[model samples]
Target: MRLLLISNSTMAGEEYLDYPKNNIKDFLGDKPVKALFIPYAGVTVSFDEYEAKVKAKFNEVGHDIVSIHHFEDPVKAVEEAEAIVVGGGSTWNMLHLVHKNNLTEAIRKRVISENVPYIGWSAGSNLACPTIKTTNDMPIIDPLGFDALNLIPFQINPHYLDKNPDGHGGETREDRINEFMVVNTDMYVAGLREGSMFLVENGKINLIGKLNCRIFKNNVQAYELSPKDDFNFLLK
Candidate 1:
């Protein structure tokens, strides 16, 4: 399986997808591919608006994208796609539509069997995990099931922060994750900070950013892994 799972889209004061655009270019290669885009996670904006924004960014990087909604058969679209791109928004909404449209298996098959490239950010990254149980998104609605595409064995808490903002009395991100660990003791959860991403290909995985990824597991002390360290362990 091949995947580029990003933590977040835009960085502070930067253009949409600016920080990762070059990395995206490298991943897709110079041949240029018109990727199939899944934009169902976008609840506040129209699919067209979301598609346009992502399309503009992809085009700038010598690639192109078309929203899955454009096709009548979403499953068939995934089957024929050379690459798949999932945009970030609401994790619940995205999985709901993905399950509603019955594209979960199709997506998994395409990426795993066909070796089609997969790129996702934020909630999109959450979609690639064994389950969306670790997602930070509020449960605005039911997703039909917590099961996701399960392209990756581990869980990713995208946009993970080390602490709550000053004056905020809410629980820290780690606290919530600790709660998850208590129940799912065997599973691994990676705190993927903003601007960082995971690159998986040919059964190997690598971290792509300056920041170190925070790792959490039950009974094990949380630790940090930098880009220089091997992330292949997560794949197993």
Candidate 2:
């Protein structure tokens, strides 16, 4: 199975996952590609509309777009897909949707049993983490308990920013990430900037992106990766 976790929407628009389409060939070996997008977490587009747009985005990226499905009936979608890509958005909102649709176990089972390639960005990346304790977005709503699919043992704060120049200056993204680490020492935190990705191929973890991926343990900097770094601990 292969898992691609991006920090955010690829290039910042509705076609947010274009970069992965170009680079995914590097990891797929010779297997044919089939992808699914879960847009339940996004606030803007309806899942059906997002599905249509994602297909176009896939074509724009030059991949043979097999199908683009929504999250309402994800199990059926997974059954028909060889790969799955969940788009970026609010982590809390996504988790709420996941719980609402009861898709956690279904997705995990497919990834673990069927070896389906799983791809996600931002909120999707956060879902791969142990829990959703490091998102920098305002807590507009809470699902009571912020949890995740635990695909990786560590906690991941995707799209991590060191500074937000909006003038609020309340707290840097790094500071919020650090706050999450204070109570969860057993879990590692990956502070990924935009364009960053964590890939799991054949169950191996590879850090792929343009920026350094900051690793934190006990609220301390454990290490950083510029690009194509191996983070097998996440897979372990």
Using lDDT, give the best candidate's number: 1
- Candidate 1 C-alpha lDDT tens digits along 67-142: 9999999999999998999999999999999999999989998999989999999999999999999999899989
lDDT of 2 by residue, 97-179 (tens): 77766777778888777887777777888887767787666665665477777777887787777678877758777676667
* Per-candidate RMSD, Å: 0.6, 2.9
Candidate 2 yields a Cα-based lDDT of: 0.70
* Whole-model Cα lDDT of every candidate shown, in order: 0.95, 0.70
Q: Ten residues in a row with the worst lDDT in model 2?
A: 63-72
TM-score of each: 0.99, 0.84
What lDDT, from 0 to 1, does candidate 1 have? 0.95
Model 2 / residue 128 / CA error / Å: 1.4
